[model samples]
Target: MSRRTLLQNAAIAGAAAVPVLLAGARSAGAKMSQTAVAYQGSPKGSSKCSNCKLFEPPSSCKSVAGDISPNGWCKIWVKA
Candidate 1:
C-alpha cells in the first residue's frame, strides 16, 4: 500500500476502535467508596438513600460501595 493509503486505513481502524473502547468503558462502571461521598448512617435533612435515584432496593446502592441504608445520606444522593 502507498504511505498515504496506509495512514488512511490506520485512521479508519482507529476511529472504528474508538466506539468499542468507549462502550467497554461505559459498561465497566465503577462505584465510589462510602467515604469518598461522605456517606452517613442517618439522613441529611430530606435526603436519604430510599429517596435517592442511585439507591437500590433492600440495602444496596448503585454508586456507593457496601451495604447502604435507606435512611442513610450521601453527597451524591439524587432525588428519585
Candidate 2:
C-alpha cells in the first residue's frame, strides 16, 4: 500500500482500460456513412486513396466505409 504501488496499480488499470475504451468508441462510430466525407480527386498532389497508406486493396479505406474509388481523395488522405 505504498504510494509507488498505488500509482503502479493505477497505471496498469488505466492501460488495461485503454483497449476497452477504444473498442467502445470504435463501435459507437461504426455506423458512420462514407458518403458524408464526399471524397474527390486531390488537386494538390493528385493523390488518391488507393495510393494512401490507409488504403485497403480492392475498394476500401481504413478510415472510410462502403465502396471507395481508387482515384478518390478525402481530407484524411495521406501519402503512401
Candidate 3:
C-alpha cells in the first residue's frame, strides 16, 4: 500500500477506536448521584439543581441536560 494510504487507514482506525474508548469510559463512570440521599446543599448553595428554579418538567432532572433518572437527584434540582 502507498505510504499515504497506510497513514489514512491508521487515522481511520484511530478514529474508530476513539468511540469505543469513550464508551468504555462512560460505562466505567456509570454511577448514581449522591444528591438523592437528601438535600445536603452545595457549599455555596449554587451547585444545587433543586435550587436553580429553571429546572422544568418537575420530574426530569436538568442538571446533566440529559435523561436523569427521577430516582436520582443532583445539587441543581428545583421545585416546581
Candidate 4:
C-alpha cells in the first residue's frame, strides 16, 4: 500500500495527521469544537471516498467502523 493509504489505516490516530487532544483538558460533558474541514477537490467524475487515492479501502477508522465514510472530512483532508 502507498504511504497515504497507510496513514489512513493506521491504528494510531494522531499519526494519521489528526491533532491529538490534550490529556485531561476537558471535564465530563464538556463540549469541544467539532472541527470540520473542507475538501480541496479531486479529479472530475470522482464519486466516492473509497475510490480516493488517499483512502484506505476495506478498513475501519478510529471514529467510525464497519466502513470508512467516503464523504468524511477532517483537518487532514487533502486534495486527490
Candidate 5:
C-alpha cells in the first residue's frame, strides 16, 4: 500500500478503537476506600447515601468501596 493509504488506514483503526477503549475505562472505574471518603454508617444531619447522587441502591455506592448503607454518610456525597 502507498504510505498515504497506510496512514489513512491507521488513523481510521485508531478512531475505531477509541470507543472500545473508552468503554473499558468507564467500566473499570475505581472506587474510593471508606476511610478515604470519611464514610459513616449513619446520616450526617439530612445527608446520606440514599440522597446522594453516587448511591447505587440497596447496599452499594458508586464511589465507595464495600457494602454501603442507605443511611450512610460520606464526604463525597452529593445531593441526588
Candidate 6:
C-alpha cells in the first residue's frame, strides 16, 4: 500500500478506537458525582428519577454518580 494510504488507514483506525479507549478509561476511573450535576427539584409534573429507567432504586442511578433520589430529576432522566 502507498505510504499515504497506510497513514490514512491508521488515522481512521485511531479515530474509531478513540471512543472505545475513552470508555474503558472512564469505566476504570472514578464515577461521575451526582452532586456535580444540577438536578431539577421535584418531578416535571410527573417525571422523576425513580420512574426513570436509569434509576437504581433507594438512592442510586445507573449513569449518574453519588446518591440518586427517586424524587430528583436530571436532564438525562427518561420515562421508565
Best by lDDT: 5
lDDT string, candidate 6, 1-80, tens digits: 89999999999999999768645745786454565446765787788998999788798877677777689898767788
Error of 3 at 53 (Å): 18
Residue lDDT tens for model 2, 1-80: 99999999999999999768655755776623465556764433677887788688888877667777787787666799
Lowest lDDT block of 10, candidate 5: 18-27
lDDT of 3 by residue, 1-80 (tens): 99999999999999999758645744675433444334332333334444345344554343344444334445444554
Instruction: Report the C-alpha displacement of residue 47, candidate 2, in angstroms.
Output: 0.9
lDDT of 4 at 56: 64
lDDT score, candidate 2, position 27: 70
Could you give candidate 4's per-residue lDDT for residues 36-57 as a string of tens digits? 3233233234444554454565
TM-score of each: 0.65, 0.52, 0.38, 0.25, 0.65, 0.55
- What is the clash tally of candidate 1? 0
* Regions more than 4 Å wrong, model 2: 1-32, 41-44
Which residue pairs overlap in candidate 4's backbone? none
Question: Per-residue lDDT of 1-80 in model 5, one digit per residue for the tens?
Answer: 89999999999999999767645754789676899789999999999999999899899987788999999999888999
> Candidate 1's residue-wise lDDT over 1-80, tens digit each?
89999999999999999767645743688666889789999999989999999899999998788999999999878889
Candidate number that wins on TM-score, 1 or 3: 1
TM-score of 4: 0.25
Can you rank all candidates by lDDT, best first?
A: 5, 1, 6, 2, 3, 4
Clashes of each: 0, 0, 8, 0, 0, 1
User: For all the candidates, what are their Cα RMSDs to the real structure?
Assistant: 8.3, 7.0, 10.1, 13.9, 8.9, 5.7
Judging by lDDT, tell me the better candidate of 3 and 5: 5
lDDT of 3: 0.49
Comparison by TM-score, 3 against 5, better one: 5
